[model samples]
Target: MATDQHLTEHTTAREELLKGHVLHVVRDTVRLPDGASATREYVLHPGAVAIVPLLDDGRIVLERQYRHPTRQVHVEIPAGKLDAGEGALACGQRELLEETGYVAREWAYAFTMYPTVAYSDEAIEIWFARGLEHRGARLDEGEFLDVIAATPEEFLGWVREGKVNDAKTLASALWIQNVLAGTWKLDWQAPPDQP
Candidate 1:
């Protein structure tokens, strides 16, 4: 049987305005079975996408770049913010090209992430990309990075060794393993990749 970890009891205690980006305040004052109540405030974000582009021989492509917010260079799956109204796969393809300068023969939307529900609305759609061939990057202004290739086993090992710590990348990499092993599924009506 599948285990259900959903919280059984919880209610909003209060909300405060700390900053603006889609309501920056949140409170979790609702009591639990153990009589515990706590309040937490977190940031809100629109959402994004992550692409795990894989090579026919099992290698996965990653990008190393500086995240201005963290002020650290981190290796992550190719990803980007949604356009004014761009679909996930479209955005994923664009990001794959812009960040890694590569294209895939096939790609599939794998899953999604809420980052932290208690914190923000930054959900991200993860894509599993394959059939890769180099195409060269189309970097936008002020962007810089290098493409690094690692095998799937190496990628997962990196996660275990604390090298690939990006949440979306980790989750999507695991999902790719599952999907390739026939244990994962796609939505019945997944939106088609934008041309």
Candidate 2:
């Protein structure tokens, strides 16, 4: 096994393979720890945020939407990619509002995860929200999804039954379970610039 410092792959050369509207693919020549050379290809991603909106009724907001690549509708937490120069928290708040029509009074930073670390540098920050008010969704044009409420138990069950397959959502659900069980602690705070 290699030590931490020895595990680093030094990029010697890079080639831009493709650049889509949201995805940028690259191929890189790297120097391995043992002075070997190899090629690595991966996707460069603009980080994103996912929010677990906890309603006052003890249920959380969820969405059912079609995922084109998978060709299957999946249940997920409200989430969105961070726009250029946008903060993760702001993206979370914006996504929650646009996707679910919900605004949260309390927001807690929960977890940050790499959904596809092996080949992609994508990260999804998870947030927990409460003190919600329904203000009606402001979805982006061409966006179509159904908003629903589910207890943590129900969501977890879906996960266990292989229903909730989205990586970030499953991790967020686990965070919720631990938070509710007092095993995980969340630092709740008001958004900056808000009274």
How do all models score by TM-score? Answer: 0.73, 0.96
The number of the candidate with the highest lDDT is 2
User: How far is 28's C-alpha from truth in model 2 (Å)?
Assistant: 1.0
lDDT of 1 by residue, 15-44 (tens): 655656434555446666466776555665
- Each prediction's number of clashing residue pairs: 0, 0
List the lowest-lDDT window of 10 residues for candidate 2: 186-195
Q: Among these predicted structures, which one has the highest TM-score?
A: 2
User: Local distance difference test, per candidate?
Assistant: 0.75, 0.90
Clashes of 2: 0
**Candidate 1 Cα deviation (angstroms), residue 178:** 2.1
List runs of model 2 lying over 4 Å from the truth. Answer: 1-3, 193-195
Per-residue alpha-carbon lDDT of candidate 2 for residues 1-195, written as tens digits (9 for 90 to 100): 757867899999999999999889999999999999999999999999999999998898999999999999999998999999998888988899899998889899987899988799999999999989888899999999999998888988998999999888888877889998899999999887321
Please give the RMSD of candidate 2 to the true structure. 1.9
